[model samples]
Target: MSQQEHQAHSLKQHWRDIFQQGLQHSQSRYHAEDFEIEMAFYGDLITHYQSQRALALAEVQKKLPQPLVKLWQRANLANYYTRSAATTQIPLLPIYRPQQKASLKHQLWWRSLRFKDEIYKDLMIRLNRHPQLHLKVLQHFLTESYLYLCNDHFMQAVHQRLQQRFAHSSEPAIVVAHSLGTVIAYNFLRANPQFAVQRLITLASPLPYQAMKKSFKQRVARPTSLLGDWYNFCADEDFFATQPLDRAPFNFQPQIINQTIHTFVDKPHEIIGYLQHPQVIRAITLE
Candidate 1:
């Protein structure tokens, strides 16, 4: 079907296709120019750290005596920071957090930070255990997914380009976004308050409660003529979509729907794999 079509059955198919298409395009466009250079710089930096770490570890192992060597091993080679939130009484994590269940996948990531002695424990483990592998994860997942969607300039370019596509017609749209696309789609809707969004469907979204609220604080400034329902779908194991934005901060909190999905350990947070679910399919064609 064409972009103009808004049929129930076709809409679901379009949403499914969009999720898969977005991932494919984003992967290639990731290396698009100056931004590509910046990504490359970070990748190289991780590489340099990895090489240096291996050499330094080898040297320390050869020279240090038994007990002293173990102590030195505690020192991080790459010094990569853990992205997980620290479980402290800090102002950042927020005492009034969304009631998102903890993930077993993130048990170590969460435990090392929260309800524990040191968040540094998990950070060090990641840095020390496998610098090369962690670097790859950061390159492919963190920077590629997170930064690509969050960076202001890139989003502006996308926002402008997509605005025409999103709200060009008088008919409403059911935006079914997946993974990083969720962040992009939300911001697009928020930015163009005039756009008539019939319904929003976010799958495997990373848009957390606090951050999303802060980002779209003035979403009601323009007062869109017709803004409708929002349905969010998330898998228990997918840590990215762990928290639902069903709270006060959001001008319109989404109706979050949870489910159990058997995901690949490496790519547990992906949406294309979960598109076959009936609930997810139904969400795209809502009324």
Candidate 2:
């Protein structure tokens, strides 16, 4: 790697190490076995995500808007990161079983051998029978959330995962969540309204998609419950960003600050591309 590249990687690794050290220090009272496992899990998570964020950074800089690239660099210099997946705040909702079961027309929405249904059935079949074949890159959160919706047992792990991403801090956090992470952040905030947040920034968020919104209505907290500003950002061609907060469902809380950017990058959906914008940086780190 080039010297510059090596230095950048070293810096990110430094941050990861510091975070791990803090985690270790804070949890020092845990028994040796549990502490070892926690350390291993957090270590792996930071390494995996640091690599992902680095790739995203390179991609963003390659074609980021001329006006925004410098700001992006400044943000990076300050170690600001756009959260890829996250969630929040009432003492989180009690872990209890909901009375309703999966209410699809048929328990198993499949025709005997014909596979006659349209998108929903075809989608489920693919998800159930050929998930390995699909290998979608950004659908892990959806897959896990859906599993929790169907079997109550998965909720514990899902809740823990969401909680772990909260990133405890003294500074006010305006979570800049992108794509699938938007949904997770929304759910987290709604479910944990007692959890404190100063602001919420969602980019290329798919929360507006009707089917997705409907599917999770019962499972998460409503937007109205959150106690912060919700800034929704998206580009016109970002198909995943189906919903804008202003057009949110009636049940959605007061409202959100929604804006759009015209990205010069080929991949408008890239989280870093969205995050590099000056507005996005200010939203996450400044206020």
Candidate 3:
């Protein structure tokens, strides 16, 4: 396999192993069946994004000169670093707490498994040292956001998928959107007000972020199509969900119910972590 392919494969396997180990260690909270389902979903998402990233990079390389492409990439890297530095004011909460009598090796293992705020700081330091990995991560985020927000073809495909899923059904739908999916769901519901929506649940959403809100290029408001309440769940450690949709711009007649809950320490931003939260489960299943 090519170097890029090999790297992708290794990264995928690494995450799968981490997730499996986490599940095995927390068997009381999660089941074996949950592990299989989450792994399948995670694998599909990774594959789709990797293909999209390759296509985007290839298109850019074809159109732009190599020198300009490199300059653009450097600019993006610099911008990411600046933003990360500015955001350091937000304190990172501690995730690991060991028994006083635990052995040093056991404590170290727990620290690795449950990444604390110090771990995040260490990761940022390492990313700064490794420019390639830093650029790769920045490109991944930028590529996906650009495709969904700026590329007409990509947006149309997403809209088509939503139409195929909901166009024929007359019953009210309950949308449980996570991270970037929350943005897509909101946009879809706003455009297609004909579809009846019972409840809109957004988990780990970035809607409250100024950059994300500005991308809409309009004032934010609740979707008229929504017949019921909007419930938004956020984790304290989820970087994407920096704030809840409770303040200005998001506030409306029927206020959004914003609840903060704890997720798995190893994967705070994962959908599986958000889905397994007691409050989130109750919000989705409760009548």
Which pairs clash inside model 2? Answer: 88-188, 89-192, 89-194, 89-195, 90-192, 90-193, 90-194, 90-195, 208-243, 224-253
Please name the candidate that would achieve the greatest TM-score relative to the true structure. Answer: 3
Q: What is the C-alpha RMSD of each candidate to the true structure, in Å?
A: 15.6, 20.3, 10.3
Question: Native-vs-model 2 lDDT?
Answer: 0.44
Off by over 4 Å in 3: 1-142, 214-218
Q: Which candidate is the best by lDDT?
A: 3
The weakest ten consecutive residues by lDDT in model 2 span 87-96
Per-residue C-alpha lDDT of model 3 across residues 21-43, encoded as one tens digit per residue? 43444333543344221111122
Off by over 4 Å in 2: 1-155, 165-167, 170-172, 214-225, 250-253
Where is model 1 more than 4 Å wrong at Cα? 1-141, 145-150, 209-226, 251-266
- lDDT (C-alpha, whole model) for all candidates: 0.44, 0.44, 0.57
Model 2, residue 233: C-alpha shift (Å) = 0.4
Compare candidates 2 and 3 on TM-score and give the better one.
Answer: 3
lDDT of 2 by residue, 1-287 (tens): 01122234443343234333333333333222321111101223333334444445444345434443453344331221223212111011111124556556544542321222122223433333433322221122223323323333344444566566454444444555665557656766667655666777788776654434523645533454355677788865343353466753623555578888643222345543464454554554442
Backbone clashes (count) for model 2: 10
Error of 2 at 99 (Å): 58
Worst window of 10 by summed lDDT in candidate 1 = 32-41
